[model samples]
Target: MNTMTVTKSVVMITEEASFRIKEMMEHNEEQDAFLRISVNGGGCSGLSYGMTFDQNSQENDVLDEQFGIAIIVDKEDAAILEGTKVDYKQSLMGGGFTIDNPNAIASCGCGTSFKAAARPAEEQPCE
Candidate 1:
């Protein structure tokens, strides 16, 4: 595996996030699957994040290992995701995953969408 340490990771995953993801994977019976993070077009803020457990990786994927969990990010999305942090937070309302991307210049109120600093031209209004 071409896994990298957290210090050199393109996207940092916090311990809390790792624990939550591991729990989900175990519950879903996908213990050996890799956590794949991707950027996709079409959101209130021009881009959105996707997370899934992938059993296979593509040729251009970047692999990282943090907290004993395998993480994969597509090469094309690396530039926009660089320095991004994934964290899990708990509150009276409940718990959820949060993403903080250094490249994001704007984000919608929904929080799942963001506009990358270099992709301002791609921004679209919410429908």
Candidate 2:
């Protein structure tokens, strides 16, 4: 059973990030897909963020739309991701998406893994 709650500003997506994501969706031919953001256990810093294009929503998923894009976040992860901001940066070297999470107390050197203030840190060797 999938339940959706329309949230206001649960996650912030910058215009640059939206443009890049839209371009990627078009390139992958997944225009109808929803961008799902999830927090999973077992990163070097107890929590890790995952993003993928999902065609369908799962049980207890919260839905939000921004910059002409549909976004979903699992109910279980809402708290950890609340007030998070997603941005894309371009430099002479390269370009990539960066996440600014207020709940994250510490993040690994890799930048994808983080330790939330409400969660205990679990250190694991990065594979």
Candidate 3:
């Protein structure tokens, strides 16, 4: 049986985001690479989204597939990333992969750090 399956709270990948990811993988100087998402404690607001191409995945990493792309998220961070969509929007000014996270109660203008609504009250500490 297939143990891994995409859930309704999957991280969607847009065509533009797929193209960019594919390009990054193709030109990757490293032999093994995978996209990783994690929550860090440093942003204009509070938490920040960390994205990087990794060569290894921890045993507790949550594996997800979208648009033929493999995504890795640590178990501890999965809750905050689920239901998030990675999309690319282009305009005359600029464009890049934008992460839309339903779990985020509020995100700064940079869209990097976010405060998850479900986080422990003590962790957020009322702001």
Candidate with the greatest lDDT versus the true structure: 2
Which regions of candidate 1 fall more than 4 Å away from where they truly are? 1-7, 119-127
Q: All candidates' TM-scores?
A: 0.88, 0.90, 0.79
Winner on lDDT between 1 and 2 is: 2
Arranged by TM-score, best first: 2, 1, 3
Flag clash pairs in model 2. none
lDDT of 1 at 88: 97
Q: Superposing all C-alpha atoms, what RMSD in Å does each candidate have to the true structure?
A: 2.7, 2.1, 4.5
Model 1 TM-score, all chains together: 0.88
lDDT (10s digit) by residue, model 2, range 14-119: 9999999999999999998989988888778878988899999976788998998889998878888999999999999999999999999899987779998776
TM-score of candidate 3 versus the correct structure, residues matched by position: 0.79
Best by TM-score: 2
* Pairs of colliding residues, candidate 3: 47-113
TM accuracy, model 2 = 0.90
